[model samples]
Target: FLTAPTMDDKIKREILPAAVNYYQKRRLVHRLNPQPVTEIAYYTAGGGCLTSSEAVLRPKAEIQRLRETFADGSELYLNFSDKPWVIGGRQIEPLGFYASGPGFEAETGRKDGLWFDWYGDADGCFLNARNYDWLMEPKGTAAMGRGPEGAEPQFANRGDAVVKRGPLATDTAVAVMREADGSRRIRFFPQKQMGFVSIDLAASGFEPAEVVALDAEGNPVAGSLDGVERGSGTLTIRHRDPRVWSFRLTPGKGRTGR
Candidate 1:
């Protein structure tokens, strides 16, 4: 192949010239003496150059013979193809990055998992870095107090969890459930906080009704929600200086627009 002005220039300087010479000698000899010649291939243990897949499949004896005769960085062609050739094999190395632990929220009742990202300043590209969620805990705490899993080795988030999509901005109606004795009760939060927060409802069904925010204790906080037939139901958390938010919803019941 023709060399580009950039990367291929380095390829030409390092491996192509010698490979052309080696092939030329072989071709001349074949033209003069019609005897069969054994084809020898060289494989890169790590890798230095590129040619073809078959280049790395020669017998041990043949490969040794070629190596002993040629210099370390030599390149050669498979045949008389117009393509530029390199003698040595390719080079490979390990890939590297950074990892972090999971997160949990009390008010929202949602647990965020361990996460990871590439290590470096904001600029450099991460070669093969990926964003992953860990379901299990880390192995152990460092002597210096490091790692996300509470500085203790435990059955922390070790597996990946599926990313769940929250309800859309639109108001959607959902089911409401209460024990027959009214002792046990539950409520839905908006799509955003619903997974973690809970809302207190007077009853179910889409109607102009008052919805309030409640803690795990079931005591109602300040503020009320405007109920809608469609879209996620949102209740503004009142007491806290900056009001928190949650969805008013329920499952098992069919479609309620949010």
Candidate 2:
């Protein structure tokens, strides 16, 4: 629990609000009871020096096998031993980021993965990805929020809530959660200051002949869909509002039969 800052005015005014918001978001994740929650995962590599084990060139593949760690984004820890007698240096490829897939990457590697040029002060660092804020802090961060339960859940419940989700391609990270009621809770921070996003919904069984943006309280917000003029297939949403948006995708025009 985060208490309001009672000290410096700067701390009280600036930091407390953010803390409160984060706490509220965390509570929201808890309230989505019986749903599968994803917590930030940390993967460790580089114990080969002690055991003299084989070097691992593909830590990403190892992390993949440990999918149980986190369903969404996670942190990869690459440890480097500074021992004077260690041979060659424990090396591993942090595969959290790849051009073809979604994964984590160390923030320090702004343009590429962490590499040793042999002149640096030290080796190994706990990395926060460039998208760490989007992946961990935000209430809807896929890595920290609840996701649809998995197939053959070990403790499956008869009344657990369920949701559907689809992958999206965007310049930056976006969080999406499809509810049991066919509504969508989206967390998209437009890379551009203006509000303009094209969603692949509103077509077929996706829901609603038309779509509208709603605030968390279910009040309609000022927004528009390209479908009004363009057609149904690629519905583009233009809303200049908050980063998090909720939409009701019911009253669909998709296939109902067969």
lDDT of 1 by residue, 22-103 (tens): 2222222322233232333443333233234555564432322121112222222232211122344321111101111111
TM-score of 1: 0.19
Best-matching candidate per lDDT: 2
- What is the lDDT for 179 in model 2? 49
Residues 87-195, model 2: lDDT tens digits: 1242333222211012212211112222211000011111111221211222222332335333222111122111111212222223334445555444333222233
C-alpha RMSD values across all candidates: 25.8, 16.7
Give the poorly placed runs of model 1, Cα more than 4 Å off: 1-136, 139-162, 165-178, 181-210, 224-258
Indicate the residue-level lDDT of 86 in model 1. 32
lDDT of 2 at 164: 16
Q: lDDT of each structure?
A: 0.25, 0.30
